[model samples]
Target: MARKKHTEMSFLDHLEELRWLLIRSTIAIIIVAGACYFIDDYIFNTIIFGPKDPNFITYRFFCGVTHFFGVDDTYACATEFKFIIQNTEVGGQFSIYLWMLVTAGFILGFPYILWEFWRFISPALYEKERKKAALFIIVSSILFFIGVLFGYFVVVPLSINFFATFQASSDIVNQFTIDSYISMIKTSLIASGLVFEMPIIIYFLTKLGLVTPVFLRKYRRAAIVIILILAAIVTPPDIPSQIIVSIPMLILYEASIIISALVVKKQEQNG
Candidate 1:
């Protein structure tokens, strides 16, 4: 059947289109998740549990950096973690496995999801704007993947290093539940991925007249404060770690402002 024009579609039709879009996106995630099951061991052991090990690549890199700088901090150069991950519930491991499979699926299948979303929205866009669908998907996916990596490599390690070694008393021991560990990992990866889409989000919001470059500039200080707070929340409570996390986010905010400006300029030119 031929697709109806946007103007010809009723509210119910638009809702139906959105429903199918979600259905297709869900199916794509499930398909990718099925493939992820094959590498479950690697995902659980190497990727998820890697940060718990003191010898993980991120820790080693930081250790090397500290050595080069002659820093006396043993936190970076530690050879072991003080915490143990345990699953108290019989089905906890199974539940976590399924959750991670879906998470991995969504991350890997992000571009396809974007394609489906674009197709749904493309009908409402001008021909020239719709032509940029591939660019949008590519850039969005790249940014998301980069953000995931940042979360995994930079944020996760710092968090694990801090919490794993924190000592309230010599009598108390830290035994983290598997559920909590996976929850942290999931939140970090997903949050970072979404945060990195700031520029793309700003671009669309600008086009929709909801945001402006002047507004972003005027509230630059507020944005910076919020970014720092977010950085502190995600990273270890250290100046260096917070700075490391905040820098990329600050750069993205500035870039969003520029993108918003260009979008407004183009809209004005067309008008």
Candidate 2:
């Protein structure tokens, strides 16, 4: 019997395949989230609240750097800050917990999700390209996890330290809502994770002829400006923090250019 070609599948068949993919992905997330729910203590107190503490690893690392550089009167070396994270709404904490579980589930099940996503798209690719499913998942997952670590360690600590210590007057206290704090964490992690996928995005765009290395190089300066703006938005309103955040992004952009060039080269060779 002859194997059916991917183009032979009807629109309904595609929809049915998509439905199953969604079902499988959702079930994977739910199962992981269910396990995360049982570890509420660790999730809430340790991971979630860790950056709030002056003794957190990120804070300590920065403090060490500041001390090593002999920087005086900097927030990095400060041992503590005055702030209270309160749940103003009755369901605020509960909502945060649920969201945390879902976030954890997504992070942990990201590889599986990527695999399922690749499965959906692989049918349209050549057999040689289809063989790259494992490479695609591995590289994407590594980039995502690196982004998460960067957000949690660098961006989160910088923002938390800056905001927790900033004040208009001595009389004004920093009382952040629980939801607000969680939102900061979520935004940092998710945004950075997505940002780190720029190279992969560029690869696909290049493959589809939507983007070229020449175009990227031509607009490189504009991209740098935009990246700085994003860094400032995510991090504290300080030059150093923004620079630190922007550096990785600039590196990602450069990497993306290389990836795009390589893709174009491969296409040229094949053609």
Best by lDDT: 1
Tens-place lDDT per residue, model 1, 46-117, is: 999998999999999999999899897798888889888999999998999899999999999999999998
- Please report, in order, the local distance difference test score of every candidate based on alpha carbons: 0.92, 0.90
Tell me model 2's lDDT, rounded to 2 decimals: 0.90
Q: Against the true structure, what is every candidate's RMSD?
A: 2.7, 2.3
Show where candidate 1 strays beyond 4 Å.
Answer: 1-7
Instruction: Name model 2 segments beyond 4 Å from true.
Output: 1-4, 10-13
- Tens-digit lDDT track for model 2 on 175-211? 9999899999999988898899899999988988999
Clashing pairs in 2: none
Model 2: which ten-residue window has the lowest total lDDT? 1-10
